[model samples]
Target: MFTNDTPRQGLLGRFVAGLARTRQGLAGQIGRLFGANVPSAEDLEALEEALIAADFGPALAQQLMTPLHQRLSRRDLSNLDQVEAALKRGILDILSGVAPPPSTMDHQTRPQVLLFLGINGSGKTTTIGKLASRLITEGGRVVLAGADTFRAAAIEQLGLWGQRVGADVICHQAGADPSAVVFDAVQAACSRGASHLLIDTAGRLHTKRNLMEELKKIQRVVSRQMPDAPHERIMVLDATSGLNALVQARHFHEAVGLTGLILTKLDGTAKGGVVVAIADQLKLPITFVGLGEGVDDLQPFVPETFTDALFARS
Candidate 1:
């Protein structure tokens, strides 16, 4: 867990840096919309364009400015700082209620299963490895299950992460039953009394019929082994994908309930405002955000800093 007391550097530092970049990108757009003496309507339009450009989605972007427009219309238009403050408040309101990650995620139980599900190229496997490393650093034993039997490299990649993190990995040859792999992994974790078990499933397009069915089967098998296993079902989203990320979130929710979101590749895209769009539309809390490629790049989502990073002056 990232606390406000962590001094805001390194992993948190890079995250703050990324937020600054995103805010700069957004602010540049808003600044361009108006000149020396801006009218109230012009400021409102400028703010809307700024947010939309940041990937807040048009509907949400406009909704955010509703109150801001009212204030701007009546407030002293002589102060640009006032405009900035109103814009910040509007953006903050949309995300103020973004829920925090579950308090029960302290991983007190042995073999706490986390099912990592996402389409290919969404960085699911890498995220799992990083999470495992984090758990280990926090004094938890981790076991990884390579249930992504569809791709040979997928299993290999997970094994490599296991080796790097010094966690046990369970995987069969390619094309084996994904469910069996998970079943065996759970049994092993139970026997070894591992603190956590992170399962890596095959990354399939949401459109794949057979692949999705296989994923469900894996979930059922885990439940049968341990009725309360897979305590967390995390859906990884590629932040660079824009609104299509929303489509993937909905599809995955329909396929299997998502407890929260793990947004990856945020450092690679300035469209981080998609986070707001997702929260407004899905109401699924974003538990983590990946700012870079390092093993420690992941950070728990912080709404205040996130708002400042997007709309606050750099």
Candidate 2:
């Protein structure tokens, strides 16, 4: 419904296209009912099914449809415009509850520490670089600690990004203690008078006890280096991972009190609605979102801009 070559389309085109494909799985069943003057029980049932199948989850899909269903119950009920309006409003209402973005720090300490945590392939390391780049662009000196010493490639990747963004990165050899690397990074940041210290921890599995312990050790040492350090513990989640993402989030939040979330792969995922579900479920601020694969792709999560992208006219 959003293809008109209208200039207002802008990002809405890409947003709709991304979500529309996911909707295709249910389009056949719900397409005919949509924009119809009087939708049948089959139509409403199909609509609900579509939402659930899209991985909005059962509770969320029902909550999204509650208002629509309530209004559609009236016998005076109306045309396709009414149905479309109801559906749009219902989805928008649920999104309206989404919380705001993370606030910038006041840099109370010598070097403010922001720890990045997530499972393997959760995009934790890159998010550290992205954040560091942002801090640099804002005129804040940043020092990155390649604390994921278990993976040689992780260190190399972080170092590469640090150079690209013109930030200093501290690292040690593979098999080196991760905590030790964090200690060095914090010391370097403090010694150099850097404003921010972004630490990239090993992307360990939530099921791995040893890995979780290593993270705790890293945090303990970082705090000792600069009390009140690690001002924020950010968890990076893959938006495309669907329901599993929420489970991962719960584990991370349990492991380390997650101060906020950095949802990556949003531009490439139709399950972007999961952001709303996460927000409604955890209520943690979505600190950042990866819109594309660029140094500047990551942006502070803005609730209304995101909602506009999700349901804006394409």
Candidate 3:
């Protein structure tokens, strides 16, 4: 169970701190350009350049500049505060459009299966561990399925997480068939009456057709046992990958149908603006963000908090 001392304020503070680099790169630049002076055309151009530099992508940068351009054309002289507010509104608009719907899992389905997808080194294993910890704290009986039999180390790593989180781990030997592993895991979960079954599959590059097909096969195996199984198919994205992350999301969503995204390594990267690009272009809701290395650092994504963090005063 989560400790009572884990205050809401603390989590929000962490969210802000994790976004420090991004805010510095984005809001810091804007602040220097518009501080105390009415932003001129050159200032606005520099602001747009900063947005693009922060990984907002060219398209989103243009959209964010639209209101500024309109205000400038109208000669609506505005203070730095007004410019900041306009920028915030623009970012919030993009994020809010792709806000996720409330999550609901049918209790009748027995073990609610959640399948995680991402390329290697995208932190899929760590995300699963963090999620398992959260679910267990919420009083749910959880089981982890190590379907990443391609890597013995992955199987071992998941086993360690299962032990740490006090959840059962269903795994097969290295080089074993991943689909077969899932087949057994579903049966185990059903028999044990687990509330949640978290499946960790082998990480493969999005460009690998065979690996993608393997993912589809695993999905098929799960559905055959429980028609509504694999209740959520979430793609874990490495935020530091910038535009490459967007490409990976697109391909994976096309291949296996992603229900949401979990962006990891947010704290270490300055290109956090990729969050906006991903939401605006793909329209995929970001469900959670990995803020730090701690087990509890993976918090549910809140657009308002994120926007506030990005534009936070120095």
Q: Relative to the true structure, how large is the alpha-carbon lDDT of every model?
A: 0.79, 0.74, 0.86
Candidate 1 regions with alpha-carbon error over 4 angstroms: 1-6, 9-12, 32-39, 76-78, 101-104, 205-207, 312-314
Candidate 2 structure quality by residue, lDDT tens digits, 6-114: 2344444444444554445446446777557676556677877876776678898788777667766765346655655676666555545554423455546767888
> How far in Å is the alpha carbon of 227 misplaced in model 3?
0.5
lDDT per residue as tens, model 3, 189-251: 999999989999888635589889999999999999999878889999999999899999999
Give one clash count per candidate, in the order shown. 1, 0, 0
- Flag regions of model 3 displaced more than 4 Å: 1-8, 101-108, 205-207
- Model 1, global lDDT: 0.79
lDDT (10s digit) by residue, model 1, range 69-148:
77666765655666667666765666666656436366556678889888898989999988888778877788999998
Ranking by TM-score: 3, 1, 2
Determine which window of 10 residues in candidate 2 has minimal summed lDDT.
1-10
Clashing pairs in 2: none
For candidate 1, list the clashing residue pairs, or say none. Answer: 9-13
| Each prediction's RMSD to truth | 2.4, 5.0, 2.4
